[model samples]
Target: MNELLSSAIKALGEKFGGQVSEFRDEVTLLIPPDKVTAAATVLRDEFTFDMLSAETAVDYCPQTNPRFHMVYIFYSTTLKVYLTFRAHVNGDDPKIATMETVYPSANWREREIWDLFGIRFEGHSDMRRLLMPPNWEGHPLRKDYPLGYEEVQYSFNFDEIDVRKPKGVR
Candidate 1:
């Protein structure tokens, strides 16, 4: 890590406890859910991570201890650097502090995460579905979410498919 980023990470670690990991030239900090807002502010003001490039989520199903991970990507235009912030949330009622206040662009990104991953952002002004319908029951992106796809019928199974086909179907 460069001197500036290292110093910033040190400051963040001092103020709020977090674990840092690096891979393929990407630095990711697994910070607490509650400290996200404050930490983002500090990074934006002091470290020059002015842009919230992207906000997304990852689901680790069947592991309730940390069922989901909210991935935050920050970009520093002047420094030409990218930093990642990750926060873990449990499967049951996963919720995290809203980044919308700090990064206005997070509005839709957070909504998309909520819609797909079912991870709610506390204090978000508008919490609603982004891509899915309002009445959608379960988050489709979840591993445990039911797959309702129908099996495709081939020429070999045409007889069987016709037997099950609707009476008035084309």
Candidate 2:
């Protein structure tokens, strides 16, 4: 398995001009934005990685160009192997082609990534908020987003004597 993964990664790096940073039994293909869909297709069809395990995004803010990333994890029943691919996008304009055409299960996962990270999944049949309420404002998962919370006060025993803070502690 390791040997096959290595050979695949090597061939991909040579053909696609990507840096094969990590490869074990599961191959990790770090791809550029323009080649993401093509790379995914190759992995799914040629490499026999058919299953779409997950589609998610990662924010790497405060970095140079393309500070965010979207990851896709695939598993192949025929090959009995796993493969991962990543595509980087500008934090300000985080958008990428949807894999739902290739793997229908990606519809919800892509929508989730958009709802959380604001990563637009182009070509997604229906893109909407999956976890957050419909009226929610910002993408809560973004690094720059505030935690939006408010403090609340409650009294367990109103009948009991009122307690006051120590003289100087107030």
Candidate 3:
């Protein structure tokens, strides 16, 4: 609702046909996956959203239309305003263009998303695991990723829990 944000939104809407959603005074521009880099470039170069504050993804599994939503947060020091961009990625093969070229700080954030969500970033300089081990089999953060849960033992259910728990070699 601020003057700068209003102008930015109008400029973006005119340049790129993206859907704008506002909640709690925060604006989110929903752009296509392929236009992420372009939109980010415009935001940084034209609107002065110079800093890429954070980049992350959310998994909405079972909703194949857009299984994941890639979220990017930007901040402008001069204007002291924040803007967010969200791009929906298909579930079949979740992938999107990298914004590293536009925002250098996005390099590691992209890598982290790749490592945790199995979402690939096309044109990434180094597309490798940022947090998980290189040998790690699957993305642990995915909604479909299997979790290893241990049975809880209590005074009354100790025997029942022990029967379900995995045994270790003595």
Candidate 4:
């Protein structure tokens, strides 16, 4: 890590009790769910991580201690660096305060997360499905989501396949 990024991570860790995990040239700070909003504000205003490049989530279902990990990627236009932030959201209440107040572009990104991952962003302006229909039953991208698929048949099984294939739908 460079001197500047090291210091910024140190500051965030000291201020928000964030934990750091690093890989190659990237660092991810895991903040408490309740402190995520305040920490994000500091990153934008104090550390100059001006752009919220990406906001997304990952679901680790069947292990509900932390059902989701909300990821926020920030880029510093002035310094030409990137910093990533993460927060652990409980399975029972998968929510963290919205980052739109600090980064306006989070508006749509958060919606996409909510739509696909089923993690809610508290205080979001338009908290609705971004890519899915409003009547969509559940977040389709979740690990526990039930997936339905049609089987493919080859020439060897054409007779068997034709027995069950519907005729009038097409």
Identify the candidate with maximal lDDT: 1
User: Which has the higher lDDT value, candidate number 1 or candidate number 4?
Assistant: 1
Off by over 4 Å in 3: 167-170
Supply the TM-score for candidate 3.
0.91
Ranking of all candidate structures by their TM-score, best first: 3, 1, 4, 2
Estimate candidate 4's alpha-carbon lDDT, on a 0 to 1 scale: 0.88
Residues 6-31 of candidate 2 have per-residue lDDT tens digits of 66667677777666655554557788
- The residue pairs found clashing in candidate 3 are none
lDDT of 4 by residue, 1-170 (tens): 66777888999999999999989979999999889889989888888888988888988899898988889989999888889898888898788899999899999999998899888888899998999999998888889897755558899998898888767865
lDDT of 1 at 153: 82
Off by over 4 Å in 2: 23-26, 150-170
Model 4 error, position 100 (Å) = 0.8
lDDT of each: 0.90, 0.76, 0.89, 0.88
Per-residue accuracy of model 1 over 23-85 as CA lDDT, tens digit each? 998989989988988999999999999999999999999899799988999999988889999
| Local lDDT at 168 for model 4 | 89
**TM match of model 4 to true structure:** 0.91
Off by over 4 Å in 4: 159-170
lDDT of 3 by residue, 53-108 (tens): 99999999889879999999899998898998999999898899998899888899
